[model samples]
Target: MELVSGLFLSKRIVYKNGTPVPLSVITKSFEELFNIKLGDCYKKHESVISRKPTKLTEFLDELRKFIIEERENKGYR
Candidate 1:
């Protein structure tokens, strides 16, 4: 028997400015925040989606924290 799973992929990032950030930018930000090679975050997200059931909000919240931490670490004003 084949087990089917629902894979969650972020279609887009909806910013507070009511703008839809492009996938390219989201991917790039993730890379910068995590200090990972370009495209690594996308691969990791895909792997997580395949392994578990994750909510979109939960994922975004975690990503938000990472972004904030990265900025603080970089001393971004």
Candidate 2:
């Protein structure tokens, strides 16, 4: 993934707690890892908001959806 505006430029995926979750999971598993808060959100602009301690699986799922939608937006078959 690419960085839109903050320190969360990239993330990796791996397993944890006998669960195959993305490395992003660490954002919550170890909040201290990034000096971020769980479920804490930031308002970038009046109409824009960003998230910290983001969940990995959620990120990937959304990323996939975005990519697909982008493709469709660009008239992909």
Candidate 3:
């Protein structure tokens, strides 16, 4: 029997005030804020409907924290 799986993929990103915020960042933020994680989705590199993730959720939290930490560590102001 074929097992069911998922593939989650998304476009580059969404903009707010013309800021090129990566989609991953936005998703990461949501995943952190509400502790929300989704499972696998059927996604492929080329194809609109072929966007999905294998795991519904991610273990990473504190999306903002991570961003801050990265900036600070790099001494980017």
Candidate of highest lDDT: 1
Off by over 4 Å in 2: 1-56
Winning candidate number (TM-score): 1
> Model 3: number of clashes?
23
Query: Model 3: residues >4 Å from true position, as ranges?
Result: 1-17, 39-48, 51-77
What lDDT is reached at residue 70 by model 3?
100
Worst lDDT window (10 residues) for model 3? 1-10
Q: Residue 51 in candidate 3 has what lDDT?
A: 32
Error of 1 at 49 (Å): 10
Candidate 1 overall lDDT versus native: 0.52
Model 1 spans with C-alpha error above 4 angstroms: 1-12, 40-77
Backbone clash pairs for candidate 1 read: none
* Per-model root-mean-square deviation over C-alphas: 10.7, 11.0, 14.2
Q: Give me the overall lDDT of model 2.
A: 0.44
TM-scores vs. true structure, each candidate = 0.33, 0.29, 0.28
Residue-level lDDT tens digits of model 3 in 31-74: 57778663322231133233345432222325557888999999
